[model samples]
Target chain A: MGSAMGVLLDIAGVLYEGDRPIPGAVDAVRRLRGSGLAVRYLTNSTRRPKRRIVERLRSLGFPVDPAEILTPAEAACDWLRREGYAPHLLIHPDLEEDFMDLPKSDRIAVVVGDAGPCFSYERMNAAFRELERGAPFLALAINRVFKDRDGKLSLDAGAFVKALEYSSGTPALLLGKPSRDFFVAGARSMGCALGDVTMIGDDAESDVSGAIAAGVRAAIHVQTGKYRAGDETQHDHRPSALARDIAAAVDLLVETD
Target chain B: MGSAMGVLLDIAGVLYEGDRPIPGAVDAVRRLRGSGLAVRYLTNSTRRPKRRIVERLRSLGFPVDPAEILTPAEAACDWLRREGYAPHLLIHPDLEEDFMDLPKSDRIAVVVGDAGPCFSYERMNAAFRELERGAPFLALAINRVFKDRDGKLSLDAGAFVKALEYSSGTPALLLGKPSRDFFVAGARSMGCALGDVTMIGDDAESDVSGAIAAGVRAAIHVQTGKYRAGDETQHDHRPSALARDIAAAVDLLVETD
Candidate 1:
């Protein structure tokens, strides 16, 4: 692969996993930045606002700025503004801060995320009612399952999104991972063309395959965070290369450059 | 069409809607029975137990025996007993009385129904965890939406069933409407062959199309309850006949005979 001008990095499982930073990830990120590549921290996490995510990254000894992070919530807000729609949010309470500044309007859109314990029949019905009233539906991410804090696979927002889609008969506009627009937005934020950027992450489907399908120059599959053995073989879109971790992935990229 | 020996009738839209019974439904059911056809009230309702449903029907002046109603919950219990699997039920609280008599065993099956307000994230995750452990997944119904008591379409158990199926990557064994086994079971309960039975209901997909797909002698789509003007034309399996209501459906059957 040719030298990339920018890199998109997945946070959870790539840099850190649940309050603990991956070994050598902090140094790897610093070294990669020193090599003069424009970098963006991309995540599908909807449980926290971008502020909290940046704070968490900083607390883990990685140099992160609020401006350097890209989230589906932010992307959704941007889209909502462009479309002149006010969101009737069905999202986690902790993540509500992200949408607090948006302009309120009568033109409503149902926005769904992982509401955690707040997912109830009444709430889901309320969102369904909105969609039935012809409101556009927006989903942050539609990944089926996620590794919960308890280390067991649990239902993610994608399942709830699917439920609303089934009930309302309206296809939700995806604003998060695995969507080509999300990847392109991340690349655009870094001031690079989609074909001049590389992506590194542990998740085969969302991070690697998503970037590859979005026309990224290359996507490196890293065996860290949520990655199981042979995950690379599960999807139709193969990653450009497989690395032991983000540090090794950085090494391969820098060496080629 | 050949004269039918048995009839499977959907309760909500065909016999009644919400608290009020459909006009002429009482006389229609009685007149159909007087014609010497065995009648079974088949419903996908998981919100209430069979006893309560029978009581409601009787109170509305429809002569109904508890034995005449065949609910998906009852069907599921029978399947659980036959398979020797104990149920880990995620059902409406009012419906729990129906499954109270099942034998306890170590082998567990996750049975999902319309739990109303009881569908919390913790409970859904618990069910997902059970499914992850290799337990059989059973769904009482998978109907996308239903006309609520408030007369608005609401999310039904089918959406939640899809959620679990997506998260666990396990297909649920449907024990309600649209499943061939549920229709066949209703016919067998009256000791009639599938070809000797006819179905009548307002729901085009679940009631009429489902019965037709299961090879019933005929299915009459009644234009009442949740039935919209163009519902009969929505699916490929068109109803054998379209009637204004249950009374008209019975009139057509008796006149043909």
Candidate 2:
């Protein structure tokens, strides 16, 4: 086949939920390796940096690398730079490394990054107060909900973003998946056409559906991360293949690259 | 006309932004007296305590009693009681005032509140570790974003909750909008049928659309807080009446009431 056969993977539900590996996740990656194809992992996960995502995968016995991973946060930083900040005041934990030692300001604000539950009323009051002064709301990833390894669903940055949009009546600029920009960026960086790629993961809406819309020929949805057996209806568009585990996804894909 | 014809008001966007009153908000409320109808300030604001909301409105020159206000937080608390909470962690400024007085949790982990741009990385790390244990991602009000009178937007506690959800892959229980329990509580407290009441608000989706979905027919949209000219198309369901400002909203509804 063409370079279009390159594989893209999602780790959370695909490889492992936590320390425990998914049923077929490990063999899936090993099998993809047996076919001798390039693999990439992409996730909308906004938690730990790429290093942790990789480390966690290795701990779970899945063949993964930090370089192979692309998170919405990384895309968020890139997206922010493409549209230069007005010295935006950030509301995130430890953004210093990401902001590259830029000075902080209370004057200008752009709502970016993860909204940890550690968020305070004082924080809410401060932001609300700032919004009252007319600052723009720029959210990193507007995902309303996210699921953890144990397969429990919870609110994500998007839910809070929606809340603010409703409360303040301010429009937000979303920079992550389903937005189309990140999808395009990943493709450009890969230096490949859309045909050569397969987005494999648990989330059908963001990863698979977004990849499909971005022109990927195939998207393999693994029931590994937040996706459970009964959540088929949650996806607006169906995946090219459905595998019980990650290894099954690799087997499902026709090796080309 | 019945009492249903009277003015059903919305608090946040129409009357104020942040802790300060909107420029013409108090004046508009005073003028509502001429309409010869009772002004009931209905709010979907879930963040603040009821007494605080009432106090804030009273300080802004509008006469408001505790009964005149309806918040999703109260409704959520009620729901929590009905459903049950096992000693959960809290991340708000004033826990005793918000949750401790209500029903208590057994296995609480983190208790956070507003401390500003100073959200430490250490704090976030600790929260993640506890939540990794899979305690419920609990919150009081899920509204994180806010607009000041000048319209500057910023993230609040809801955003923090969102961040945690993304990191740990857990969902939160919103004590506010989209929760039918809250609306039912509001109607119950008001001792009115959910359909007979009218909700006047400026937010296109959250307030107006929420009210309509809750069976309120008359919703007034104003360009005061989150309302702008371009907001007309954000939601398919528009308000029953459109007002340029709260003054206009009162002017139109006063006669009918």
Candidate 3:
């Protein structure tokens, strides 16, 4: 497998939903690997650290390397380190272990994601006060909604991110899916040019349209996981291919190759 | 001194700053009363009950009748009763006493205000679930920012309200200040026609512009609580007169008479 043949895979709603892997999703990844295709798991799950996420995938019988997962939290850490910004993280406690190595300073930058229980008025106000005193605002993902533990749709970090944005009159710096830079970086990490990689995801906007915008060769949108009826017509940039599930999506990619 | 010539007053930033009354506001209201002007205090303070607000005003030496205070909570309760909605309230605990008269049922309508400590991810998510199940959404006030107990600017209910609206794709029906119906109702309760009332407040949008849209005779923008520089130029509906503070606003009304 070379850079010319690679796939960027979305984890949630693509591989495993919550703790359970979608049926045939593991087999689909295995088939892609057997075909000599490069695979990188791109996720916007801000509720847990990368180590935990990798652990969950392994327990679910999926073969995943910790290094191959490109979570927005990890990307945000890399971006913050490069810019020399000290983060005042407003994220779930489970996700804080990822940034324990960063240097602490009074010069704080408000780093936020789907904090779950941590999204309190005090925490948000503290973040707002920091922004009012001239601190930058950063977000892991601005996803509107996510599947909860019970599998019902719940308010995601995007709503709170927008709240802080409106309250402080400051725009958030996005570092997750649908961000062109993040998508291109994922392609580069796979040792592939943006035009060589095929993106696969359940979300039309974040995965398919985002990969297209980032210059991916093609994107396959799956019908499972958060896909509503008429999503294909709802966007100006339609997915290059559509599949019933991860199995069908992998089959389409193999046949096309 | 009758319904033919009435004045609508705003609380908080106009008559008082936190616990302390604004320097001549007490005397200004006293003068308005002495002149036999019909006065109604229109407030969007969802943090406290109307009884507490009336008590606070009395303690500050401003002669305020309980009937004169028009709180959004009271208006919301009235609307809920009339519309036959059993609300799932997301508000400060202190304000819950105001809705004690409402009958309870499983059919929920999300009633939100400045929820203060009651604003948690669990509660917000619960509200989101209710809305997803087709519950109607209502808001007492959606003011962007409010002065906290610590005298610092804090994120108000508007941020959360907008978040819920974005998450559910449902618009919240506002029942507080800046709502045209609330304004007109306050005028009617005073036995005054909307065209005979003159509204005065520090907030340019909610108080002045709202009054103008409600067909009030005139509106005076006061430079007091929550009023920022350039607020006069920010709105399309300019105030009929500008005043240094509540005292000056009262003076303007008296001079015109």
Best by lDDT: 1
Q: What local lDDT does model 3 show for residue B237? A: 85
lDDT of each: 0.89, 0.61, 0.85
lDDT of 2 at B113: 36
Docking class of 1: high
- Worst lDDT 10-window in candidate 2 chain A: A96-105
Report interface Cα RMSD per prediction: 0.8, 6.9, 0.9
- The sequence of per-residue lDDT tens digits that candidate 1 reaches over residues A54-142 is 88999999988888888999999999999999999999999999999999788999999989888988899899999999999999998
Residue A147 lDDT (model 2): 67
TM-score for each predicted model, relative to the true structure: 0.96, 0.60, 0.92
Writing each residue's lDDT as its tens digit, candidate 3 over A88-146 gives 88999999999888866656788999998779988988998998788988899888787
Model 3, which residues run further than 4 Å from truth? A1-4, A104-106, A209-215, A228-238, B1-4, B104-106, B209-215, B233-238
C-alpha RMSD of each candidate structure in angstroms: 2.0, 7.5, 3.0
Better of 2 and 3 by TM-score: 3
What is the full ranking by lDDT, best candidate first? 1, 3, 2
Model 3, span B1-257: residue lDDT tens: 22338888999899999789999999899888787779999998898888899889999999878988898898888878888888888998899999999976666789999997779999998998899899999989878777776877888888888889877778899999789888888888889888999898887777887778778898889988877777877666889888999899888767434
Residue B75, model 1, lDDT: 86
Q: Better model by lDDT, 1 or 2? A: 1
Which model is ahead, 1 or 2, in terms of DockQ?
A: 1
Best by DockQ: 1
